[model samples]
Target: MDSFSHAFIIAIPLLLAGNAVLVPFAVIGAVIPDIDGVFFLFPDDEPSRYIFTHGGITHSIAGASLLSLVAFIGLYLLSGISWFSRFFPEGVTMMAGLAILAGAMLHILIDYLAYPGIPLFWPFSTEKFTLGIFPGPSLMILILSLGLLTLILTGRAGVRHYKTYLILCLVIFFIYAGIALYANTETEGRAIPTMDPTRWITIVETDECFVVRPYDILYGRGEEISYRKYTNITPDELAGIARLPQVQRLCYHSYIVTAERRGDTVILRDPLREEKVFRYPLDHSSLVIPLQETRSGPLPKNTDRP
Candidate 1:
């Protein structure tokens, strides 16, 4: 989910529980998982410092906990200050810690549902996991946001009445979640036969691709500023492609990785990391690597990746 989605999702409980004072802390906590991205301010894609400073550590489950603790302490301190007392309905309380923890946890869970996955049990394992619910943002966030807004505007979400809306919101989330997952499965089923994919279980579009966003199939093109297919690799060639260092690195960072062979060189790409080509969804400093795969094995062909 994006930060706005995270913010809205975290706001629900805070608003309904009549502790709207915690909403600010919760919203910040939801985005804390991505806070490390701040380092990206100074040439974020610098290979030497890339993984060490960004998503690598902060997106982890353990990272969220540590972030929550820090947030709790910060919120606790702010709760003590009398300056901001006028803003919060009841000022602040120690329970804001719980709100921060919940928001951060949801952030990790939401990311877990997407591709290239997250390192939840980092240090213990580097394995990634994902439900692939949708390649981009999920619809659950939008529905909840709209519904919550409607209730708030109609004056139906007062202290006692807000609980009813909250319950409805959760029900709507579960239903939409089921439909979204099912829709992805359906799209994958259709794409496999039509796309003529290299992998049996999945289909990686060539040249052009469509993503499974909330309620629609979104058309996407690489950052060529125009759509172009730069490479094409045969099925038998994938083994050699996977062994390439660039492909491995791309796979490590992406939830969905695909390949294309450009004559003598192999091109490894992550459709989820489309920004390397399109620059949307915030680039995250991705680089496309070209590979020279031979019958013996794969070798790095590009001395310049960045």
Candidate 2:
């Protein structure tokens, strides 16, 4: 989810509950996990850079907890200052900290439920877990959230009606999710949601190739648009390529990668980049390494190479 959507979605309930003190803190916490986005500003040429990239440690459970704790300590210390103490009493710091922690957790949960999930157990585990039911930066949700925010700001919808508006928003959100879930049912492989709630993209992996296709909840599956064939490179060669720092980073970030041979080099890239259906802002560039024929004997029979 985008920062605004994260803040507004979390803030709405707090507003309804009338916890004004914790609202700002919680909003801060919700958007702070995205601090890792700064990594995107620089070139992603170095493997070490991926450690700080989006959906990395900052999006993990341990990282979020540490951030919340640091934030709590900061708030606690600030409350001791005379000027700050007048406005933010020391007694409320603990509660505010808890609210911030909850907000951060909520942010992780939202991302986990969306397509191309975060590394929730990062450092310990790099595997991403996602329900793939919601598209990140969902247009529908963003528009609805903005509309609700406008109503609140304009005084057209006050605190008394917050519950009504919130409930309505949730219903619409869930309805879209339900549609996505229905479309994803019995999917061949990973079902990735697109901006359109009714539309999805499926990536099915085979021993020989990776099949990419478009799917729609209302129209059923579409024709195959991409078929990325596995390279004829031997397993030993593949293992060596995987050991390279750059390739390791690429594999860590991309869920479905394809290998292709170009002359004396082998290129590895995420197959999703070939299609326009579901475009994630992740690093989709190819990692090319020189082809090194390390073995002297014939290639393994399981490999597609002759």
Candidate 3:
């Protein structure tokens, strides 16, 4: 799941346990597990600090348990209360620590369904156990966490008033996903033409692509910018495109430049551009042709994204 969704999922339990004031702390606790992956910020760099070690520690059940125990002990001693009394009679710190541990544990559990699974019982075994489904583990986290949050919040009478908002959010999200899926699918789902790391561009049918501005919220959707059929390019040109350093850096494993044929020339369109760029005599697979480039401007239409 996205960060917002992950945080919301962790915050819900804290919200249920404490009031609004504790939500931030709970979110911090939840995000602590992921802090080990700090190298994510410098994805291209090797031997980055915080990547080699500390990844599974905070994310593991054992690590969270240790933190929880430490919190319990620290709270008891700081408050100068008997252990039983601290836990039973006035268990503020203990409960708070448990909330933190719960957040971390939940983070691990969510990552299990992700591509590279987390070690629930670390130190027992170093082997990773993943669900091996989607490559984008964050996406699974986003959907499930948000869904659970919606379900939990829906069950509460006080939050019932916001049910319409939640439903609206879901509807809008699927609408965008539907369009994005359509764009990618219709275009043959190639890596080069369809994948957008920034998610600003979504492939529609061949020769057509839609630009969608991403959202910042858990279930928020983006607005689509439709780029109508423009020009056609040949497979050789697409292959040449795959050789480019920029495209290689961006899409990587999921690159595909799909072309649709028309009349004597194979027309290729730049889905990201406003003007049409054409490619002629689309055949002769050995010939490598350069794709045309164009400038972009403000969209002709306006729509809400975030």
Candidate 4:
């Protein structure tokens, strides 16, 4: 979710509860997890730095707690300042810290629902878990959030109606989630939501290939859009390639990856992004490694057997 949507969605509950004092703090917390986005400004060539990338450790439970702790301390110290206390008479309290923590957790929850999910247990485990119910970037969400924000800014929507607005947002999210969940059940593999709520992309993995197709909640699954075939690299050779530092970093961020042998090198890429099903920019890009560098020598074309 975008920062705007994250702020508004988190603020709704606080507003409804009349905890207006915590709303600003919570909103700040909501966007704090995204601070890792600054990593994107620099090249991610170092495999050791993967944990610092967007949607990496910061999105994890441990990372969130650490961030919330730092943020809480900052808020606490700021509240002690006489000038700062004048504006926020309530000052920082335990409840304020909890509110910030809650906002950060909510941010993680929202991202978990979207594509190429977060590693909730990062540092401990790099495996990413995603419901794949919502598209990475939803035009619908952006427009609705912006419109609602406009109303609040213009004083057209009063605080009294916050509950009603929250209900509407929940309804829309659930409807989309419900459809995607049902579609996933009917399919063999995962169902990835598209920009259009009604449509989805399904990926069914096989021993040698991954079958990708479009699906519709109202109708049914459509024709195959992509068939990513795995390179016929030997188990030992493939294991060595997987062990490569660069490939390990890519695996940390991508849910599914496909390897293609090209001359003396093997290219690793996320099939979803490679197929353009997930249109949003990804944290990891394709990686190419020379085959001679693996434990085994250059592989024979289309033959894994020694």
Give the best candidate by lDDT.
4
Please report, in order, the local distance difference test score of every candidate based on alpha carbons. Answer: 0.55, 0.71, 0.42, 0.75
lDDT of 4 by residue, 1-306 (tens): 888888888988888787899998899789899999898898877886767777778999989889999999998998888888776688888988998999999999988888767878877877777777777755677777888888888889876556666777788788878887788787867677777887887777676677888888788878885556567554455655655666767666554677777788888777666656665446565778897767533222211000
Tens-place lDDT digits, model 1, residues 225-253: 22222337554555555444434445455
Query: For model 1, how many clashes?
Result: 5
Q: Which residue pairs in candidate 2 have backbone atoms (N, alpha carbon, C) closer than 3 angstroms, thus clashing? A: none
Candidate 2: tens digits of C-alpha lDDT, residues 209-252: 76777887777888985555566664455655554556656666
Residue-level error in angstroms, candidate 4, position 203: 1.0
Model 4 regions lying over 4 Å from their true place: 225-229, 253-255, 282-284, 295-306
Clash totals in order: 5, 0, 17, 0
Q: How well does candidate 1 match the true structure in TM-score terms?
A: 0.56
Give per-model TM-scores: 0.56, 0.85, 0.38, 0.87
Best by TM-score: 4
Q: Assess the local accuracy of residue 108 in candidate 3 as a C-alpha lDDT between 0 and 100.
A: 68
TM-score, predicted candidate 2 vs. hidden true structure? 0.85
Error of 3 at 150 (Å): 17
Clashes by residue pair, model 4: none
